[model samples]
Target: MLILHRRVQLLQMTLVDCTREKFSKYEQLLNDAGQKPEFWDVVVITARDDSQKSIFDYQISLKKQRHEVPSFVKYIVISDPPGVKVGSGGSTLHCLEYLANNFGQHSLSQWKVLIIHAGGFSQRFPSQSVLGKVFLTLPCSKYPIQMLEALLMMYISIPGKMNYGVFIAASDVIFLFNEKGNWDFRVPGFVAIAHPASLKLAKNHGVFILEDMISPWGKYRSDPSSPAMVATPKCFLHKQTAEVLKHKDSYLPTVPI
Candidate 1:
């Protein structure tokens, strides 16, 4: 058991937000994170809205600037429309599913993936002087990191005790890799849920779930403030949740940490 435990490795992932039409700017985040030829392969997950051809073009341009081919960079395009397009959490979930199915394959299960949302910043173009202010200005609870945690915990079940983590930041956020900060995959569990102080300020500290008051997949009722507005597990965890738990009596509840 001890030998097997020692052999166990978690997945280190970085789920860059590529929902935007332009991806050229996203490379800077990777560069700042100390991306190098020695670094492991990076999978750039894109939504259905993103075209592989366009992404390749962006990568080519970036490579010219960097003066080297980003051999470590890989792209995985998701068929689901991103939250900005169709439904909330749809795009992020698709990315998670991609990791779970593909990374969970044989031999690969031993690795830990660290997910970093390149688009976690509030603004794409932030000045150097205001970078510090931007980092401190964003609310932790509202930070996309919360959504990342809730989504991963609610979904993605690993076979072994293998764990996962995310590196979230608001604009002006910088991730430095050194003696203290390394790409090593740690144990499975909540490594860190962003700045802990932010949780204390949340108005509703509990999980925010969608309630489906209307039944039989019908249209909205005349009254807008129906039970569907607040009663969840009864409504659905997500649109995808509605598909599986359509038994009318079935309830799919999600627990957020």
Candidate 2:
């Protein structure tokens, strides 16, 4: 199951649209960027809770790409605080705070946000109940998982139009690159990163290694047919989610897998 979080108050939304529409916007935004190819900052929230030795090498890897990391890419590390354990959900909270502090004030007019981490998604497979069995599909329209994707599009579609948006891609994704640089935005489509520890793809371990930085803004261009969307900002977990689960959850609730 996939889950994305967003607030309606943050963006003046429209009826949800599909990938083609968003790609058009991505193109238009680039066109509108004052004649020169534009770029946005990239933020990398590395879940480095483990005391591994290659962490520094990972930083060097990104910096070396400084020449190729795209003018808009800004790699950031949200390392575990001292001895915090990986997968504790602390990384997610800290990642959020770091974004609020660092990119909070950017023009954000033509940028989009991408969070690629090395972790498995929290697989919340619902169980049987009086309602027979609960199917765990993410609601793309007014659903639990896609809300954040829609919110992010709204924010970047109309800068100064949206508040905040985050799109977390599972760490296992290889981030295949195309010189053409095409990204189709569809929330609730990918898996959510379950654990917080990060791994560089260059390492070649069973672990994932993220290789690309996606553009954060300018994905959708057409006006959505639906009226501005209302932010749900719903809590995903039950009353005792924390007590039931030993790990610290996303400061926000997470739908049980």
List model 2 lDDT by residue over 147-224, tens digit each: 222322332333222233445544433221111222233333332221212222212222221221111111111211
True lDDT of residue 208, candidate 1: 28
Kindly list the per-residue Cα lDDT of model 1 for residues 1-257, writing each as its tens digit. 56433322110111221112112332333344464422223333332344532543454455446533234444333444435554324445555666668776431343333333323223444542222222122233222222222222221222122332332222233321111112232444333221111222332232222344234223212221111221223232223334343344333322111
Error of 1 at 93 (Å): 3.1
TM-score of each: 0.33, 0.33
- Return model 2's CA RMSD, one decimal: 17.2
lDDT by candidate, in order shown: 0.32, 0.35
